[model samples]
Target: MTILPDFRYIRPANVDEAVAALAGKPGAAIIAGATDLLPNLRRGLGEPSVLIDVSAVPALALVEETADGLRIGAGVKLAELALHPVVQRDFPVIVEGALAVAGPTHRAAATVGGNLCQDTRCHFYNQSEWWRSGNEYCLKYEGDRCHVAPKTARCFATYRGDLAPALMVLGAEAEVAGPKGRRKLPLAELFQDDGAAHLKLAADEVLVAVTVPNSAKGLVGSYAKIRIRDAIDFPLVGVAAALKRDGDKIGQIRVAITGSNPCPLPISTDGLEGQPWNEATARSLADRLNKTAKFQTTTTVGMRYRRRVLLASARRLVDDLWEKAV
Candidate 1:
């Protein structure tokens, strides 16, 4: 049986204590729900000597509606977020994404921050320790080469988080707390294109919350994804679309995707503004997404099949949301 490496567990009472713990410990990992981290730990993916638990930080558990839109504390549970009245009324897409994750029990224990900061995964990299050692390991963890792309120096592990695409398309921003104090940045900036080093957060930094702008309010949106199964499996490819209507035309639109690359990516909707919203337009947008997505052999699904399904799913979601808007 695979066993987790020994680690010291520290549960901080507040955000300040949490940040301090991380800054002081050289090999530290911030954990909320442990829904993702524990599984990875059992697989021997990480060997952090210290695990800082921030679930008790009251500041990280608030869900407030301000003039700016909504502020969701990073520690908010996925199940709670999915059932939040404001989220249900104003940001149904976020609710959809939250509910799509893993299973009901996972949602109950998983936090929004945990989902956002979850590690990237690949079939070759997420194997048992013995299995990985037998395969000589991959670039994401121990060895030198990326199993997905041996010719390239980059790791091709995919980020399969459901919330990222949904939150990103709505123009959300991430609030971070660190030794330098607090700062806010566009949520998309939190991630990079590299799988081995995907998150741009410093070792001492902590994700505090996520804020959705008032500009995203009143927009019609939808989230859709295809997975290997109906439950307890990460998405193979996911799509989220949010758009504003200008009478009979499009006012503004944004499309984001996950499980295709190391980072969740936004498909540019440039020049789409003020254009007629129709089936043809949806098809065009879908085609653009299919062309923009960079798929690798990171999952069991064939790249061609993933590409085809992404195109169809994006097209269908846009079409459905447009119909609802009309």
Candidate 2:
């Protein structure tokens, strides 16, 4: 059996304490549920000497409604977020996205922060140390070259977060706390194109909470994904779309996708607003998305197949939202 390496553990009571624990240690890793980190640790992906546990930080687990929209603590469990009545009522897209994450048991222990900031995964990088030792390691691990694309100078691991695209579609903001201070940024900004350094968060920064905008609330939306099985399978491609209707036309619209590339990609819906919702328009947007997204050989699914599914999913989501317009 693969065993986790030895590490110093520190549990902080609040965000400030958490930030302090990670202030000086570049090798320190933040753990909430350990659902994602523990597996990677056992696989010898990361060798952190220190672990800062923020699971019990009270402020990070609270989910409350605010004047803006909703404030979801980063430490909140995925199951809790999925089952929350307010989330189900006001943001069904988020509810669906959360529910689609993993099996109920895994989601019970997985935190929103962990999910949003989870490590990128590649077929070669996720193997056991012994398995990977047989060949050169990928750029995400100990080696200098990426196995997925050795000719390229960067890693091509896929970001597999389900909630990120959903939250991005709804115009969510991430509240990050670091040693210097706290800052709120668009959730989409948290992701960088590089797979090795996927998250934009600094080593000492803690993702405190995610706030959805008030305008996105009550907007008709849909979240869909392509996966091999019904449970416990990571999505091949995931799409989230939301829109506000004004009379018979769309007043505002947003579409975001994940599991398509190294980072979650948001399609430009600038000209979509004020356009009458229809299958033709949706198809056009899907075609544009297919041409715009960047895909690599990260997952088992081929890039062409993944692109087709993503475009089709986007088209279906748009059509569904239009039919169910409120």
Candidate 3:
């Protein structure tokens, strides 16, 4: 049986304490829900010396409205976020993403912050240590080269989070606290293109909350994904769209995609605005997405199949948003 390594577990009373606890402790790892961390630890994917548990930090569990917008505490459970009346009414796109995560039992324990900060996934890297021992280790672990692309110097693990694209389209921001103090940055800025260094957050930092603008409340949004199963399976290709309407014409629109690349790719909607939403226009955009989607062989799902789903899902989302608007 796979066993977790011996480690120190620390629980801080507040954000300040949490940040202080991580100071000078380079080997310390943060844990909120442990839904993702524990599994990786069991597989010997990481060997941190200490664990800082922020699950019981009260401030991180709040979900409220502030002058900045809707504030979602990082510690809020995925199940609570998915079923909350406020989220269901104003930000259904977020609810859609939350509901799509794992199974009901998992959602009950998984946190929004943990979901956003989850590691990039790869078919080769996610296997058991015994299974991985059959071949050379990849770059994501302790390997010298990437198995997916040996000639390439970087890891190609795919980001499969369902909520990232949804939040990206909504223009969310992440609130982080660390030894350097608290700072906020665009949610999109938190992700990096390298699979081995997927999250840009420092080892000493903790993501405290996510803030969405009030402007997003009135926008028509949709989240869709293609997965092997309805439960527990990660997305093959997920797409999210948020469109703002000026009477009948589109005022602004944002489209974000995940499960296709190292980070969520936000499509340029430069020419899409000011055009009427119709089947013809959607077909044109769908064609463009088919050409632009960059697929990697990081999952069992074939790259060609994922490309097709990306195009089809984009078109379907456009059609769905159009149907909801008028």
Writing each residue's lDDT as its tens digit, candidate 1 over 228-306 gives: 8887789999999998888889988899999999999889888888989876777778778977799999988899999
How do the predictions measure up, each by TM-score?
0.98, 0.97, 0.96
| Tens digit of per-residue lDDT, candidate 3, span 34-131 | 98999999987888899999997999999998998999999999999988888888999999999888899989999999999998899889988887
Model 2: residue 149 alpha-carbon error in angstroms = 1.8
Off by over 4 Å in 3: 287-292
Clashing pairs in 1: none
Which is superior by TM-score, 1 or 2? 1
RMSD of each: 1.1, 1.2, 1.4
- Candidate 1 has its poorest 10 consecutive residues by lDDT at 278-287
Error of 3 at 50 (Å): 0.8
Q: What is the lDDT, from 0 to 100, of the residue 16 in candidate 3? A: 92
Q: What is the lDDT of residue 127 in candidate 1?
A: 89
Report residue 65 deviation for candidate 1 (angstroms): 1.0
Summing lDDT over every window of 10 consecutive residues in candidate 2, give the lowest-scoring window: 279-288
List, residue by residue over 90-205, the lDDT tens digit for candidate 2: 89999989989979999999999999999988888888998888877778888888878889898889988899989999999999999889999999999998889989999989
